[model samples]
Target: MSTVLIVAEHLNGRLNAATARCVSAAAALSPAAIDIVVLAADAATIAAQAAQIAGVRKVLAVANPANAHAIAQVQAPQVAALAGGYSHVFGPSTTFGKDLMPAVAALLGVDQVSDLMAVEGSHSFKRPIYAGNAIITVEMPAGSQVVATVRTASWPEAAAGGSATVEAASVDATLPSHTRFIGLASASSDRPDLQSARRVVSGGRGVGSEDNFKIIYHLADRLGAAVGASRAAVDAGYVPSDLQVGQTGKIIAPELYIAVGISGAIQHLTGIKDAGTIVAINKDGDAPIFEIADIGLVGDLFQVLPELEQALG
Candidate 1:
């Protein structure tokens, strides 16, 4: 029977929902055991939270001061050290996992399978290519350890209720000195995080300018949703790159995704392909965004937004 180990992703002592989604992907393998390893300066809280994820058999807490920051180079060696006895190692295909999994694969001397969307067998999987326009099956050599990043957007978060045990783990890998946690500079926002939000409202270049983006934000706030932007909006300097959602930016699977003034480029559609309900609002009646949108409105956003906000009230 196969056994899987997942690297836990957490911040501020809280477990990331992506970790639970990884658990969902691992569950599809029907492995003998699914364990999570939490590497942190203090892993107790995170480990305890991970232990509650359904299908998890155990949580390994690796407490080390060097793990205070999520520097890929620093954590990859430790994860590689703990890979023994496991048939597969999984991580989420988020920015953190994208940065760390390749290094883990290098340390293990194996090719990393990325953005795994489906499990065909223990060693066979399916993933997207050509900006999610196509999916191809990949088979890992039998009997070889599999290191992969799970496509978080493709799997639902595993429910909590498990009473798995948490254990303290220690890895003796030689830590690299060349890389150190310098500092992190990120925008602070009261709004929900775009990647994990249940609902999102995104603006595009047609929103006019940065100042006009307030309409998008106001609508999003009224809906209690996160704010996102099309790559065109970011490129036009109407929003920051961090808020961009497309093939080149963040891939999200919100329950509700609203695209305002977006032309629905294939690249943008690729990111929201897994969204539950897509609503498009644009003046152009025949915009490509309407091709896949569940609901579309053909009107000027500047005039429609205030009325929509009032209707909500």
Candidate 2:
């Protein structure tokens, strides 16, 4: 019977939603047992959350002061140590997993499968390549372990209400001293997190300036959607780089994605290709965003945005 282990991602004592999506991908492998490994300074809270994800057989909690910062050097060893006898080890395809999973694979002496989107078999899977323009299928080496990062946007989150047993893991790996936690410089916002939000509203360079971007936010607020921006908007200093959405930024698969003033560069389109429904608004009728939009509106965004906000209000 195949068993799978998912490296749970958490921050500030809260579990990330990506962990549940990783669990969904693991379930696709038809594993006989699925377990989650939680690493943090105080893992009890996150462990309690992990125990609630459906279909999880067990939760392995590793509470350590060194694991607080999510330093890959410390996390990878703990994950690798707990990976024994498991057929597959999974992590989410987020900034956290991107930085950490390869290290785990290296420690286990195996190749890491990047961005696993579909499970063809227990040992085979499909993933994207060339900035998501091409998809490739791969089969893991037989009898060797499969270490993969699940493309979280491609999988629905596993349902809650699981009754998994949580236990502390016994690990004796030497912690790395080369890394230390400093501080996080992040913008605090009441808006939903772009990667996990169900609806997203993005502004592009046509918004003119950072001040003008408020209109986009107004519309987003009315819709109760997460605010995002194109690379141009970010590069032009209208928004922080964290809010940028493109091939070089965050990939999202929201149920509704609305683009205002975006010309829809290929890089930008790559980020929203998985969206359930796309709505594009721009004066340029030929803007590339309209090409893929489920609903296209060619008009002045300056006037349209205010009107749209009022209508929603």
Candidate 3:
């Protein structure tokens, strides 16, 4: 049996939900021994946490102060080298993961599978192409290990079990640098992270203004949902770019997704196509959002949102 190396992602000491999702994807590829590699400024703490993830056979820790922050240059080679012994390497399709995996693949002298949706077999994989309008099946070439970044919504998160053993590994601190962090300008919010949330509430041009976005926020709060936006809404300055969900933005697969006042475009739907239950609310009954929506509401969003919030509350 071959081993699969999963790179654990973290911020501060908390494990990113994507890491658990990766483990779930790894399980689908093979039930073979799954090992999690943690690169942290403090290895002991991260290792302790990683050991609890279900299905993890071993936790490998590499503590280098330079690795405390998630930078591609800091972790790429370390992950590449650590992944050397495994038959496959898997990570999340996050910006950090996408940046780091290419370097790791380069070090392994193989092109990565990149954003795989399904693993058909040990060597064959399926992925989206042309902005998710088509699916492409690929077979890994000879002499190269399987490398892929799983889309977050494509897999369910595994539960964390009791403790497991951790081992220490040495990594070279010196690697190539492309970009340096200045400061993080994260949006201030209590909402869930869009890509990983179980429920999502999205707004669009019909939202009218930045001020009216509060209605969507209230609805999201009542439903315990992460907030998302259409590209037009983000471009119109009603929301941040990060909140945009589409082929060009973040892809999400929530259990429930509500699109408010959004006239869904093909690009926007691509990011949310995997959502389990889709609800669309738009005054224009013919809006494309209704085409994919499980439930469609034709009404003014201003009136509908307050009523929905009241009912939920």
lDDT of 1 by residue, 1-313 (tens): 8999999999888899999999999999999999999999999999999999999999999999999999999999999999988999999999999999999999999999999999999999999999999999999999999999999999999999999999999999999999998889999898998999999999998999999999999999999999999999999999989999989999999999999999999999999999999999999999999999999999999999899999998
* Candidate 1 weakest lDDT stretch, 10 residues: 181-190
The estimated TM-scores of all candidates read 0.99, 0.97, 0.95
Clash statistics: count for each candidate: 0, 0, 0
lDDT by residue for model 3 over 1-313, one digit each (tens)?
5579999888768778898889888888665799999998898887888889888888999988778788887688789777768989998998778888888888888878888888787878888988888899989975468878888777888888846679998965356666655577677777788878999999999999999999999888888999999999999999989999999889999999999989999999999999999999999999898999999999999898888878875
Q: What are the per-residue Cα lDDT tens digits for candidate 2 across 15-119?
A: 888999999999998889999999987888899999999999999999887887888988898889889879999999999999999999999999999999999
Sort order, lDDT high to low: 1, 2, 3
Native-to-model Cα distance after best TM-score fit, residue 67 in candidate 3, in Å: 0.9
TM-score of 1: 0.99
Clashing pairs in 2: none
Ranking by TM-score: 1, 2, 3
Which candidate model has the greater TM-score, 1 or 2? 1
